[model samples]
Target: MKTILTAATLIATLAVSGAAVAQDFVQSGTTPTLPQREGQAIYNAVCSGCHMADGRGAEGAGAYPPLANSDFVESPDAVIAWVLNGYRAMPPLGSIMDDEQVAEVVNYVRHNLGNSYEGSSTAADVQAMRE
Candidate 1:
């Protein structure tokens, strides 16, 4: 009986914690936003899952394609389009992220990752592309 009671208490505690976490994610009933808005912050939270923390991509069953010193990252528009529209294996992040976020990530990839590209993209550019 003591063991059963302990198990039940643990389950109840977990349930309450989970509910609190879920509530934190909710904002005015609309879709929740990312924790940070900075370019690097967004990259670390979202892009690094596949592209890796160092910006060097991975390959296993499928290739993630390296972003380090790649000519592809030179063009801000191209990177933005791919991120918003989705590529071969990557899913589109258009709906998940706002225009500013798309631009920030694009700019982050362009300037960092061993690729020194000229000029940074603006939110306006992303919005124009979306339209």
Candidate 2:
């Protein structure tokens, strides 16, 4: 019973901390409205830590590849696969995010962050890639 209670307490604490971080993210307006721009939300929350707000990656312990004007970011299908399986350095986001979330973030990165690609990826596309 004591162990169960402790586990519950830990879960609740994690929930509250996660909420706090989300609240802070909302207040910052770095990600914007999730309903409207889930991609930006994921990017700001997950990618911005290493990729930077502008998507210009840096070299520290490992190379954080630049997304700005990077031809490597062209294909949405390829991008989805990379996010799900990870290429190198970047950990696979599929473990943490759903297909829709992956699509949104991929779309966000494609069009924004100094990119001008005329293509976009839908949630359906991400779902297909996941399968």
Candidate 3:
């Protein structure tokens, strides 16, 4: 009887532990990292003015490209170049922001925008493209 009781207790403990592990995995699903958080904040401060808070630019005005659902942002190279050199209407901000800041902003737009791309951009990535 004692052996049976011990086995039952062990099984219960294993089941509880398994449940805890499963819960942890569920909570961690595809959440952004630290840099991505910073990137979001920076986007709110600087980029939001022209791009708008939701990344949707002025539609008819054609003042800025609508970044929210833009396919161009999916390409890391295109994003980097656009930020560095600026497009026709947008002035170049590459000179104003540091490499790290640029990366953070790019990452912010890519991840937080309506059409989000799943990847992180680093300062090194931007610097390499600059050269």
Candidate 4:
């Protein structure tokens, strides 16, 4: 009985902590901002929540499509637009991130996360998409 109680307490504690971490991603009344400016940093801080740290994605409350070896990520424009405009269950994060940050994340997701796409996206490209 004591062991069961301890397990229940651990579960409850983990649930609360997880919810708190998830809240960091929510916009709330104002737009939430991420301090990381680099591509890999931004992806780890923001995208990794749903996409997972390994970029394998997750499925629980919702379905988060994987970024690994994905054809969808080949188009930098599409990823940039999706990040800015949001897609389906994904929230639009343009308000929180600058153009450079967006480009960095695009490049990071494209080149890393089990992807080996060539070329890079410039901040100017991200700015153009914003317009």
Candidate 5:
């Protein structure tokens, strides 16, 4: 009787552990894919001149700011707005890029240099901000 009870308890513990592991696997597997892999090209064409390839801006003595360690990239909505509307010295990109392209570039910046914050920006978000 004692052995049977111990075996049942052990089995229950194992089952709980297995379920926890499965949940972790599912969560990690659900990360969304980035929209663009040609992030380098997009950056070069649009952003590199100002922000630089390393995401460090070149305005003046610590004036332009660097996106490499920026907190702005962590928030999808904030980055989207800044990209579309422009910041202090940054020009608005909305005129140049459509919603889809904006999203792709946003994803590129976020994943490639934005500390891998793992959030995706949508076209709807951009349009709404414009309105």
Candidate 6:
């Protein structure tokens, strides 16, 4: 119990102290000044950390996998599955986000990221995909 509390306290301290450093690493995305759509905003906030702002994922310990013109994303349901249930190193974001937000981000990736898929997924679709 004491060890758990200590670990939690240490984590909180590091998070507070590293907040500035974390911001420095994550502020590379396209920051929209106009009235931005929900999808774009969510990508800039969440997926951009791993998938990147350009959707061209970076190489490191097991590449983040680029979303731009990806054959993987061509199958739209795969995107939903990965985001909701996690498909390897990618964390599950379904719990953190509502259905509408998931739909927005998934649609954003499909339409943008060098993709031209003439389709969209609704919140109902995302809701159904949730684990």
Winning model by lDDT: 4
lDDT of 1 by residue, 1-131 (tens): 99888778867754764464444333344555555577887777677656766778865435788888898788888899998999888998787778898999899999998988999999999999999
Off by over 4 Å in 4: 1-33
* lDDT of each residue in 19-93, candidate 3, tens digit only: 644443232234333122367666765566567668887532346678998886998778888888987877766
How far residue 10's Cα lies from its native spot in candidate 2, in Å, is 32
Residue 36 Cα positional deviation in candidate 2, in Å, after optimal superposition: 11
lDDT of each candidate versus the true structure:
0.78, 0.75, 0.70, 0.84, 0.67, 0.74
Candidate 6 segments whose C-alpha is farther than 4 A from its true place: 1-37
Local error of candidate 2 at residue 74 (angstroms) = 0.7
**Residue 85 lDDT, candidate 3, scale 0-100:** 91
Residues forming the 10-long window of minimal summed lDDT in candidate 4: 24-33
* Model 5 ranges with Cα > 4 A deviation: 1-38, 59-62
Q: Can you write out model 4's per-residue Cα lDDT over 32-81, one digit (the tens) per residue?
A: 55667788878876887778778897665579899988998999899999
What lDDT is obtained when candidate 4 is compared to the true structure?
Answer: 0.84
Give lDDT tens digits, candidate 5, residues 14-63.
Answer: 47644644443232233333222355655655675557667866543236
Against the true structure, what is each candidate's TM-score?
Answer: 0.74, 0.70, 0.65, 0.78, 0.63, 0.70
Candidate 6 per-residue lDDT over residues 10-124, each given as its tens digit: 6775466346335533432453221224888878767776677789986543578899888888867888888788888888877666777788888999999899787898889
Give model 1's TM-score versus the native structure. Answer: 0.74
Model 1, position 101: C-alpha lDDT score: 86
- Give the better candidate number (4 or 5) by lDDT: 4
Q: Each model's RMSD to truth, in Å?
A: 9.0, 10.5, 18.6, 5.2, 19.0, 9.6
lDDT of 2 by residue, 19-114 (tens): 644653543344333433488878877776567668897554467888878888998888899889988777877866667788888998999988
Superior by lDDT: candidate 1 or candidate 6: 1
**What is the Cα-based lDDT of residue 27 in candidate 2?**
35
Better of 3 and 4 by lDDT: 4
